[model samples]
Target: MDELTEFIQSNPDPRELKRALAVQMVLQEYTYFAIRDVLQVSVGFISKWKQAYEIQGVAGLALEHQGSVGYLDNEQRQAVIDWLKAKNYWNLNELQQHLEAVYDVVFASKQSYYELFSAAGISWKKTQKRNPKADPQAVERKKQEITDWLEQHRHQISSGELVVFFQDECHLLWGDLCGYVWGKTSERIEVPMSNERQKQTYYGAFNILSHKFFVQAFEQGNSEFTIAFLQALLAECPESRIALIWDGASYHRSQAVKDYLASVNQGLQESEWRITCIRFAPNDPRQNPVEDIWLQAKRFIREFYHLCQSFSTVKWLFEFVTHRQTFNFPKASMYGLFS
Candidate 1:
């Protein structure tokens, strides 16, 4: 039988409990019969340990204790409050010591400390602010304006006239980000490993209409890089003119970009090559289709790959996506992004 299945048959939390029992039995030099005879537990429990041993080898028998009691009584709780007042902060063990010293109270284990703090509505969570680039009102306005433009020009933008490029900066990093991997569906896990390595940001541009992709590697995306990327992108799609859609970033709207746009528009021999700008309303990344694409890319990377330990991991991830998958949900992509 499969180890997991055997473990499942042996213990409720088959993998963990079976291993725990097996290790305890080994460490204590107790046989299954001896354990059952002494502890007066069921033979099934012993069988679970034996099954866990067979499945995981010795490592399967690791013990993890779940503490029984929740918290200290009212007196000990008040003592904790007093300590908090005096010290401003205390680690679980420190608080445990203080409880024992001041209130003569003792908790069964460290997990119980969490239970106590939870009951008291105290927790340590670091709040992260969103990227401080764009303004919210401007983003909303940009989204609405873009949606209106899309609605109005729906007929004009066939497979030929409208080439929408979703462009953005992607960061590389080390190790798997916790939530992304834990949240992944099994289909995501089945993706083959990527060969690329090294930490670098790639300026990615995606054409929503054509499902074509362009990438430019950069240490970062400043005004100069953006201009160069745009020039390269212009070179790639020499046939159909692309309306440059970007956020109202300092870099994107820099004097350098304005100068480049002026030069490009001036040199446009045909009406199609004439560069028109669609600036996302300030802070509203959703107005730009590239934002969603980048987010989905990041999310996909974060969901799989235990090797996602550095920015290089993030870079490798983008390369994997670009090479492996074609764009899907173009309309929904536009809607969700521009919504």
Candidate 2:
């Protein structure tokens, strides 16, 4: 056995010397038998340690190193976290590219990036929701308006002699009828549809109290469609006097809708088919039960309407969703802020 190799293997602190010896052995092109005898180890053991050092560098040569790949340094990884917080949005590949450009470190795989983001508690995709600009004060004002009017009619309501209906416009799109599939990491494929038809939009309404629902197809969200929805809602409901709670949307506040309500009120004075509309606070969809209905109804469609790929499929899916939502109304209406 050689003096240097024996010294490397036996010294009090031999980690650095072990790396130096492994590198020297490779550079000298020493035979496995010679290296083993000098290091006081089996030929296979010397070969294994040497190969590990060659592949993993000096850090890999230490006996206590355990030979596991270390994560990126704290500062380097913290840079990524700071970038994510600053941007507020990032895809897997985008983050990888940024990390590589700034830190010059390559992640092992896409799965590693996913693991990092998952561990840090970040959502990989956007969620559909009401606009952030929606006015909360307006919503509360409308809710108070409804509460005030309901108090005035509390006696009739308790008698079950008059029905209060909350109506709003809901648009149904052909492409919105599909169920959620397990999407691939970087690619999304759209399956072909068996039923092909022109895209169709619909205007629908549901009574907040009765759960009575009605929907009709339309070409646009104009005043005509809005009035048509109101008419359908009235037809579906047999109540003598129906009060409506709606948003302060342009169409709902338009002259056409106002005239229609006034006309209904005048004619119903004898049979009293009175209709009162309350515009909810400006941006608050939270207080409106109808918005909740739309959210849950859409979830049901997206989660299970797998075969839907066209207008007809969408219509059928809507029908199924409305049925499910209406039949489950009592349980569904139990939702609240606390819930």
Candidate 3:
């Protein structure tokens, strides 16, 4: 009886204490049936408690539900929810410190803090990196403009009078692209590499309608490289009007590049076939299909990284993949943006 009293007092969870008391009553010669009738617990539960007591005594009866009670009430939890919504970043350590400093509440363990967050319907997830300075209104306006342009040229594009190409640049390194790999517990797969991360840069354009690609290796992505690429692209489609969609990199908007565009469109009428440039909204790379092309190229390069040892081999691999026309950029993905 003394031991049962001590156990009930020491144990914090009411449910566990109730079970312990039931077991103690049975130990003192009270019938299991009577205990069940009084406590409104099943006979099987009484047996479980008795078995637990037999195995490890009072310690076994201490239910592992300390953090289940939760530390925050409705108002405190709403405060946490509001705070999380006001920011774009958070980690467990920072949150733990915040709870203590702001609410003067301390969780016994980090797990408890996580449990609280989970209970509050908050979850941790990896988010895509976005530029904070990007203007939403500007992005919306650009999207509308692009939608209208595409609609106006739908017939021309279907008949091959106008061609749209998305262009971007990417770099590939000789080092192992660290990604998920299956390994036995306590074992690691080693990827050998030289100290110098030899890399190669490439400029690429994908014709969204035709699904053809033009990729060229460049020593550096600069105004000179961009101008040369544009010249080659114009040469490829001398008769058809070319609408090159690209991001607002300094090289793309350089004075030399602007002059080159001006010269190309000097005598071309609004309806004539010539070169025109369309700039993607700032910090919006997902809208560009060429960015997807770059991602696919890099994925291929990383998957077969062992074959690419030198810069020459890397360049060859990139050219091989880009020239094969294997990458597919869905037209629906582009259409979905406007919707």
Candidate 4:
């Protein structure tokens, strides 16, 4: 019985795992009504799989196999493969239904269908992001512009007169902590989240020279908060000028921010401004290195989710790692090499 439970837990195929688990529960004296409530399967469904296992062992769980006596012939398998090739998408259930409907055949194992997918040159995969809004030419042009700007100001940066910072904001939701976790294969892993939407807004900056990350929590992102955060950043480094590179959020480019910049660098030229704000290309988040800083912080939350039961705990966890911590990633030096 222990071996059966272990087998059910170790099984990778979800369908087979369900069938095996249902049978295992029955043998363990779990009532049919209880199994029905737990597994969401009717009593008849449970009895069918249970009886099939009793008669044909593990092979009984499978819908069908190729050939007459539990296997399909060469021609029949080829037809199935061709049928699979005709579809742009594939899933185990769809394939099973197709085989059961067209040829009245069922493979004793899911591996048989995987073989069919392989023959059709179809491999299981997840979809990747393709950002249509990102303009390649604009991104390249901006990268070169940034490279030129950094090279031109190399002396000030080297002399510690100017500090370079990539700035961004993140909305950290309590729900973000609910991510993939390992548990017993037969059992479901549940996260205890009181309010999934409980969230905090943060302003963060990544220092290029030091690889250090700085962050501060804010009620929300707006013109007032943006300027206030900038003021806080200046207060931290009173002697050095700040070269702030960030995305073009509405607040970042608001009239209030412009007035704030103008007021600080009233008489100085653009090159000598106390705060030199550079905007990354529109809709291109890949240009900002601070993204990795936020990603790392979120990953930390996901890793230690059990510790972050409350919203206050989430904020503490974020600050504990992010405040003045140095983070060096490949994207940090995408525009210009820090070294």
* Candidate models: Cα lDDT each: 0.60, 0.60, 0.73, 0.82
Give lDDT: candidate 1, residue 325: 48
Q: Write the per-residue lDDT of candidate 3 for residues 104-205, one digit (tens) a residue.
A: 455667787777667656786646687887888888888778878878888777777787777888876665354444567697755556643776778888
- In model 2, where do residues sit more than 4 Å from their true spots? 1-70, 73-87, 101-104, 127-133, 183-189, 193-198, 267-273, 283-287, 304-306, 323-339
Q: Write the per-residue lDDT of candidate 1 for residues 1-339, one digit (tens) a residue.
A: 244445445655333553454446644678767765664444565565566567776444544344433356787676566556566554675565444333434465667677666665677664545658757776666667877866665544554565666666665543323343343455554323343343466677766555656667877768898888888877776776777666566888899988988888786664455556776666545565555566676678666656654455566666777632456655436533421
Model 4 spans > 4 angstroms off: 1-90, 95-131
lDDT of 2 by residue, 62-181 (tens): 545334333578887776776676776667756654554345345667777876686567756657678778777766665566676677776675565666655555666545555565
Worst lDDT 10-window in candidate 3: 330-339
- 10 residues in a row with least lDDT, candidate 4: 62-71
Q: After superposition, how far is residue 97 of candidate 3 from its true place, in Å?
A: 11
Task: List the candidate numbers ranked by TM-score, top first.
Answer: 4, 2, 3, 1
Q: Give the alpha carbon lDDT tens digit for every residue of 1-339 in model 4.
A: 565566676763555676777888899899999987787656766787789889887667654543354467899899989888898877887677566545656578889889889999999775756579999999899989988998888888877799988999999998888766667879976768889998899999988778888899898999999999999989987999999989999999999999998999999997778899998888878788887788788889888887876788988998998999877678988877665
**Cα RMSD to the true fold for all candidates:** 16.2, 13.6, 14.2, 10.8
Per-candidate count of clashing residue pairs (backbone under 3 Å): 22, 6, 0, 9
The 10-residue segment of model 1 with minimum total lDDT is 174-183
Candidate No. with top lDDT:
4
Candidate 2: how many backbone clashes? 6
Question: Which residue pairs collide, candidate 3?
Answer: none
